[model samples]
Target: MPKPSSISEKPHRSNTSEESCAQRPHQIVIVGGGIAGLEIASNLPKRTGRTSIAVTLIDREPAYVWKPMLHTIAAGTSDVSQQETSYVAQARNRRFVFEPGELKGIDRQGRKVYLSPTEIAGRRVLPERAIDYDTLILAIGSAANDFGTPGVREHCLMIDSRSQAMNFNREVMARILETVTARNTLNIAVVGGGATGVELAAELIQLADVSAYYGAAGLRDQINVTLIESGPNLLGAFPDRVAIAARGRLEELGVTVLTGARVVAAEADCFRLADGRQVSAELKVWAAGVKGADACAKFEGLELTRNNQIVVTPTLQTTVDSRIFAVGDCSSLPVGDAGKPLPPAAQVAHQQASHLIRHLPRWLRGKELPTFTFRDFGSIVSLGGYGAYGSLGQFGLFTGGFLRGRVAQLGHILLYRSYQSQLHGFWRGGLIWLADMINSRVRPRIRIPD
Candidate 1:
């Protein structure tokens, strides 16, 4: 790995005819190719005048997956291999440079970022590179927070990414088959009563049904799913009625929704609860909490919150430097009503990306940047094939039940589609949607053997 160059010595501006032509187009480097990062890249204005801007998107993964759909993958309902979008191809079509590299560190003083070298199949591919930028956006997203519990990092699987979720799905299916063949009981424990954990628990029930359909006899009867949470109630962020209804729905599916149960230690095949209860399982999933990625904390000279989220003002600019902007799970922007940092969710990230797309060009041209105000579009958590539950309206006065689940699911699907529309025009998005529908009809509902 080569050392990164100092930002001070790096060329900040060029003095060619192009440089003198209008305001030199600023170089915008965006980290992370997730929903937020990709949206920002796709919505960037094309270079029309002397002040053109270049956008480079960086991510460690080769493709992008709609993260909210990870639960579906874990439940064997969706195949990640077919659903993933190649970032390289999308970047080319969207007119941005895509760099597949893990972000190592950032030098705000020099306005440059150090990217780790990328390797594939034990062969070195892309060497370490330093990207200089006039404006930087950090949308690296967040990972599952384990809360430093024992054996969590080693034993439990987190469905935070496509590969991880797919691997978990394979492991789960294999375990189901093994238990059935041996006539042994199958227990799957999910830690975190939050939306992801609840949805995954529900999906597992549906997956059991699929397993039975595939000739796995007595699979549904033998399978047991447990959802653990430290809070007194599930979906703590939502209305009490919604949480209570969700618990009942989960229990109806034979999933054990254990609230106020804090997992203190995770073993290879079981987790010990704070109440000294031992719950053994064939598989364990940790989806309890989330914090910013490890790389975000390593960013030097940036003001971050206690959770390592970049501290940003109302304008979404980092407190340490105005030239750098942060969004998504990696940022902690002040919220309006709550007087706290905005919650990290897809909706907030989407809103922030849309705002940046509209105002970043103005900021580059020396115009004042507009303050980003987040709209509280309430959350909807899918309850597998059964239904969905969540609240809507300005103050969440509009409570929804099972039917709202379908609507919530559709809304979630549209969120990703909206991102697709930004990347590919509406016509292209329509074409992609049609192709997906056709492929779904022709292909097997579940993935074939790897």
Candidate 2:
């Protein structure tokens, strides 16, 4: 078996004599082991008696971390390792092949995907390689869209991935620790009114408290968190009441809520707003928006939306190629009369993954594929330990009522737990959850990197 971080360029060949070249298994390659990709890979059948199938999952990272919890990871209040699911272990248990590499390019006509060499410390770990596939599924997900803002690319930190989150955590920890001697305010300005920005603001306040508990006493008082949103309010995706509650909750926690504040540019020490006012801060985070990853632009003739997301049909197949499918935040699937695409969210990805899991076998057997219909179960936002709020949909509520406080918090947590259960099976998933609960009791929740 290959190591967790290793990738083999050679084609997977069967050792049995009965499996001849004429009867080669169908090759299914999934790129990006994110919420959708990993879920589909874990649930898809390993093989069918009449028609054999081979599954290979490729990801840039060796382990998968719930993307929704990235705010906590960036705040240094969560143990990252405890939450990550190793792709190698998952692949081994689920009967699929795992490869670690970044998708650099794609060849639609040749049915090949190009991967960049994996490197660590400026040294080569694995050479660049290509993988063949009879059918391809792209779930590469979204990245922080800077919207061509000046200095944003250079001055702001984005928590789009695990590495980016860790980098921000390190800087935050260092800056907070320095406050002990400087006796100065540790100012942080977060751009965006969405869940990412709101959650991050709340998590940073909690982080300040945790830091004080560890050693940096009075850090909470010395920290100033400002959440700037161009929109009229935060959590715009939810109902007005929910947004009002979220804004009120955040303001109560000492977070400066700035609505209708459009940031025109980012500088080393401050953000220049549209109204000529500047918000000073030592750390700036841009979680204002997300777009399909940059790599999607180089997908070799695949049709893409204005935001660089691959265009897919209702069946989740690429517009130009039936054999290639796209899902999650990376695919642009139009809905309703406006033809607006679905927002990039974990629930959207989860539903799409579930759709493919149930229908991919039919596709493999040369049957018709069903159109994917996304069911929005509503939105939930966690305000650290302060509170949580949600506008529950019919699926979430019996008679349709809003969720608040601990109920909403539990719902937010269960969202992640459900995905883990889907990927690791209920028995092991329950055990994993139990272990985490036990560990939380004995271990420190705050993570300080050495």
Candidate 3:
């Protein structure tokens, strides 16, 4: 890997249309089309003074989905299509170029990003290529970290992406339809008491209920869900009372909750605990912790943390290269008086994107950048339709109190709506929400993909 140097050198100019004139537009290439990357691409100013700003977004997936809702999609409770925004369409409408490819490598010296060949059904459709950029931003997001546990790669299913979520849904639906006899039970074990695990456990219960309603008889009775947390409580990020409330709700809904039960290994049919006991399950999901993509470590020679996250300054610029920036789950920057790394959450990504949207144009015009400050708006975890809980951290001044029940649930829904409004503008985004409401009334509540 080449070592990163000063970002003063301009990239080699190509005879592309954007550079055909005497003065070329300042090229900005953003890798990853997740929450932060897409927002930055959509909202960035198209021009900085007399020079035009050319932005390009690259990603492996063709469409963008709100990753926080993957659990609902995995349980077949929500339609992925309703939430998906095509990269092609978004780029066209937002005045940016979209390239469908994964980041292969970066040439910091040359200011070029190399992308891997794009494939469809195991065949390559586009050859590997490189794109030059005056500024590069990485927001590829994070993935589940198994902590090197044995058999986890083969035995456990992870819902880090849309395809993975759909794959889990298919297997779950197949198992639900197979439970014809009361003697056979579909046992599921979810490892991780974080928001993903707890929410998925509740969604699974709802999945059983929806399955039975759709003529898959006795699914509720024939399904067993066990939520195992290595910590003493679920939703460890939330307040203790919220965690207690979530645990209580899951228990009341027939979920087996196990706290402080560390998983030693995942076998073909069960999760072996460190205490010499095993929790048997036919389907297993691992959502315990997240780390930046392992592939991120291979990107150029940028500084990385032990978890593979790119290290960035408080301004969101990479420590090694001033022209390169990283945000979202893929980047690590410590803030606050405690100097703790920011938590991996949607709000963090959104705030970072908004920061860049405000500061990048000023940066282009050669102005000093300000440090990015994150305002804590608190966190909310929704357990499908069972209930919701939230704590307003710095935002409590406006709310006047913590939230729960329908009010907290409304807050959860509004977060996604606000995201859509930011991405699609208010009018089109409102139409999208209205369309979803109409679809919910007419379409089947559950999706059993073929």
lDDT per residue as tens, model 3, 102-140: 888998877789988999999999999999888999999
Worst 10 residues of 1 by lDDT: 1-10
Clashes found in each candidate (C-alpha, N, C closer than 3 A): 3, 0, 0
Q: Which stretches of candidate 3 lie over 4 Å from their true place?
A: 1-22, 45-51, 181-183, 396-400
Residue 352, candidate 1: how far off, in angstroms? 0.1
lDDT of 1 by residue, 1-450 (tens): 112122233244455533553465567899988778988887685622444788899998888878888888887877787678898888888888998899988876567899989999989899999997777899999888988898999999998877788899899878876887898898899999888888899888888777666777678889999999999999877778778888999999999888889899999879899999989886899998889888887888888777878888888878867667899999997765766778788888988988888876666655677678776657777886788776663544443433366786786667667767776789998788788889889886665445
Worst 10 residues of 3 by lDDT: 1-10
Off by over 4 Å in 2: 1-22, 46-50, 394-400
lDDT by candidate, in order shown: 0.80, 0.87, 0.87
Pairs of residues clashing in candidate 1? 7-110, 25-52, 388-405
lDDT per residue as tens, model 2, 224-251: 9999999987888888888999999899
Q: How close is candidate 2 to the true structure, as a TM-score?
A: 0.93
How many clashing residue pairs, candidate 1?
A: 3
Error of 2 at 385 (Å): 0.9
